[model samples]
Target: MDAFANRPLSPDLPERHSVHDMLVGAGLRPTRQRLALGELLFRGADRHVTAERLFDEAVAAHLSVSLATVYNTLHQFTDAGLLREIAVDGARVYFDTNVKDHHHFLVEDDGELHDIPGSNVTVANLPTPPKGLRIDRVDVVVRLRREEG
Candidate 1:
């Protein structure tokens, strides 16, 4: 077996430290698992991810991580403002890499997610928040089904 095959798919030093700094800046401890997971999640362009999907990637890349750990770390990252959690339904949830304010298009048939510019959506008559609470943000998931002949 080749050494590279078993190596963790982390980035080079500068990038690796950049990811490390990102975690620290977000108030999260930069542990080995967190760094490894961050490396995969931030591999390329910003996108959405689920704990299950991340776990699979970790396993594929031979990273020593568990599904439960993925879930915990994802939640921590979310709490630290490093990721945005998009709940698709009562049972499924996804973590979005793009943290900016925006809407989403959920392709119902395929369970795909696409970003909708914030300017494209307008919400009306939102019920007032509780006396001491304020509206942080609103999430709109427009469900689209495939066209039928």
Candidate 2:
């Protein structure tokens, strides 16, 4: 893990309070686990993380949080629009903090994610929705594999 990944919590900006504020802003009640895990998710730079990776980081940080709590918190964050869930593969889900309209490039071997700026792609035409249903949004994910030399 990198240094920032393992850095200690800032006393002035504790995870508990940060998570509480985030939840409150998103109209969610700040539960104990939610607060703890949300700090882990939202603090520092934006990332593409999995539940397992989050669990490991929490444990390393001595948060005493459980794996289930990580998943639950992630789901809540997604619901609250604080985190964006990307379906990169059948068995794995990646969370991103860049919630704006954009796309992703998934590195298959390492599971790394890269943001694809929206301006780089153009969608000039699209099929209209039928009936009363409306299009909420569109997501494009480009899966990439390392080319052998």
Candidate 3:
């Protein structure tokens, strides 16, 4: 159990103070744009989102944000360890709110992403890295689709 373990995964957004504190803790200056975007990203439950999807969400929420700004902000958050970047395909990328090490399951039909517990997958028999390079982490995305009947 940890400090964040108590926060419930709900539909409601977290208090602004907490989001502000999170940005500060991440060594980020909580600017107006960041605060608004952070509120949407950090609102309730660990989930995955693409930059375009997030931009649409911001627009739907009546927040005056640009798509480019959304992409830049997401990259910043990932760099600050506030989120994780998952590249499923060269064309599709997802920013995960849960920064913990874990795998994912992608539903092909619905294009939904679900988290797989870190312990659920086993990775073994890895080739040694090059002389100076080291393996930081391995991300596995299991894609699934319903069988044709």
Candidate 4:
């Protein structure tokens, strides 16, 4: 089913006043599930969210969005610079609301993400890219495991 079909291009927005307006600013067409998910996502301080975790939250809010929809929307949002994607591990990925340059800490036990300021690390000794390409950005993830009981 088309999750965005017939959904409002404008809904009750979060603090920014209009989630639809925000989506439009981000170049996304405001669909129902997208608006709902946007409200859930952009309503507070910047943070990270995984598709599975967002799916759980959507379900709890009685939204009818499927996990696939969440994944697709997240990718779309990332492509539009509404969020940033980080591959924490081979099997784990996260979307960060703060799109600026920065690093992260991955909590192993709970799979949570914590921001590490951009100034905390420096990259050096990078090989040159091909003639047609230039470096866009770099990502670093620090993993943490809890102390055993």
Best by TM-score: 3
Weakest lDDT window of 10 consecutive positions for candidate 1: 1-10
**Residue-wise C-alpha lDDT for candidate 1, range 81-135, written one tens digit per residue:** 7788999899779898777779999988978889998899999999999999999
List candidate 4 stretches off by more than 4 Å.
1-16
| Tens-digit lDDT track of model 3 for 16-54 | 877777778777899988999989988877889999999
Q: Which residue runs does candidate 1 get wrong by more than 4 Å? A: 1-14
Candidate 3, 51: how far from true, in Å?
0.5
TM-score, cand. 4 vs. native: 0.86
List the pairs of residues colliding in candidate 3: none
RMSD of each: 7.9, 6.3, 2.5, 6.6
Structure candidate 1, residue pairs in collision: none
Candidate 4 local lDDT, 1-149, one digit each (tens) = 22223223323336444667767876688999889998888765677999999999999999999999999999998888878999977898899977877999888899999999999989999899999999989998988999989
Candidates' C-alpha lDDT: 0.83, 0.77, 0.86, 0.82
Worst 10 residues of 2 by lDDT: 1-10
Which wins on lDDT, candidate 2 or candidate 3?
3
Q: Which sequence of candidate numbers ranks them by TM-score, best first?
A: 3, 1, 4, 2
- Position 135, candidate 3: lDDT: 99
